[model samples]
Target: MNNYPFGSQAPKSFPAYPKTEFDLESGTAIKRTRKPKNSPFHPLRMIKSFGNRFHHFFKLHPLMGLFLALCFVLALAMILSLYGTQYGVQSGGYVKSDMGFDDYPFSKLQNLVMVAGHSIYTSSSCGKIEKEDSWFLESYQKNPGQAATFVTHIHEGIEIVARDDSALLLFSGGETRRDAGPRSEAQSYWAVADSKGWFGKEESVKWRALTEEHARDSFENLLFSVCRFRELTGTYPQNITFVMENRVGALEKLASDQGEKLTDVM
Candidate 1:
């Protein structure tokens, strides 16, 4: 999937931008003059007022959806035709690792450190990263220092991992905001850390860091990161620490709920 944000410039994770209205607005299409929103003949208000009727456009356009489904089926068929499905998943649950599941090097780590992400960095401009305008913020997140706090968490997670040889640090957050394009909060944090060279602890922390990108809420951040940690390490962490600045009570509650003692509260 194309998980990078819009624009020609993006993180190295994805090489090419995908199709979208943003592309049209970015001059990929022929430039054309359009009426301003404040114009008297603006039609969006009326269309939006239709509510469910407006949404019926999808129901009204079934052919396109059918074509998409057909394309997906064809793509799956093509892959199956080529690969032959010899390694297809079986119905039974996972077998014992014999000794241990060590395919991923993270299997050696025994502790987990998660940094819950709050926002994504949306700026293609290098200068605007520290600015509030560069993020897709909710009403509560419009404050000036909010963006900086997120950076602090990223740095703090790296520092924690650097200090603990057994710890595997995870940047935990999902693609929660549609307005922020396709970037996940976890990916955004990791990218920022990469851009900053892991805040001068690159060699010590880079290998320990990973991302849990499917979590969308506070509890999910902890739960999903634990599942990811177990997947990587083949065993649940003995201790889990969170690095969200000024937030400890929630993490403590979640840790207790997950049946782990919070040894160090920060």
Candidate 2:
């Protein structure tokens, strides 16, 4: 009988199995060389690789990518809207109080034309005064003809200022009504004047026209506008011509107390 090892003789015709080499000096088996298995969950490298793959997919299918991007944006906008209601946000023209009043350029102007706001007017879609409501129904019924008076006052103030280049026209009133939503009577009058194009004197008077949006009554209208005049021009107005609907004796007393002259022109 052959004396060779039985298992070793059976493998001569078959492929020879590769043997692992060892370092004789260190006595450690050398590992077989292999290409690493691509792992999908590598912490540092997975994100970058996934981004690259996504970019490639988008490049291949652009229309689907655009639609997905738009959908994501819309979802984000909806989420923001849900948070927006928790905070109250109002929109309108903001009145700036800190206008560098000390550095006002029109300090030489000493003449003033001030118009008092009496009522808030909202003409109907038909453009008739009879269909409008002026803040309160009782007040509107008491003086249903005040719209023409308001327009006349606005035009007269504009004409006075247009005749004199050195005069500044000021509209004075406050947000007195709660239902008006912080809309000032002064701003309302200024809007009416603006809509009417300053009654054909826009070029001469528009630049000088401004609003004092914090006077509750006629005395405040006169007193606050005097302060506003000083703030705007850096000096008190030398000659104040008030264009108001009614004569206010308190205005005369205020002018006397301030050692200033007050003139009423209808």
lDDT of each candidate versus the true structure: 0.79, 0.78
Residues 106-209, candidate 1, lDDT per residue (tens digit)? 78899989898888889885455677888888999999888877777787788888899999999999999998888999988898899888889999889889
Model 2, range 1-266, lDDT digits (tens) per residue? 75667885654664344367767799677897988998576766878887898799899999998898899999999998866655534355334344455568676678989999876654423244333354322354366565677778888999999988899999988887666666787887788888778889999889889989889899999989988998789788989999996758889888888888778978
lDDT for model 2, please.
0.78
Which residue pairs collide in model 1, if any? none
CA lDDT of 228 in candidate 2?
Answer: 90
Model 2 residue runs over 4 Å out of place are 1-102, 123-141
Error of 1 at 94 (Å): 11
Q: Lowest summed lDDT over 10 consecutive residues: which window, candidate 1?
A: 88-97
State the lDDT at 220 in candidate 2: 90
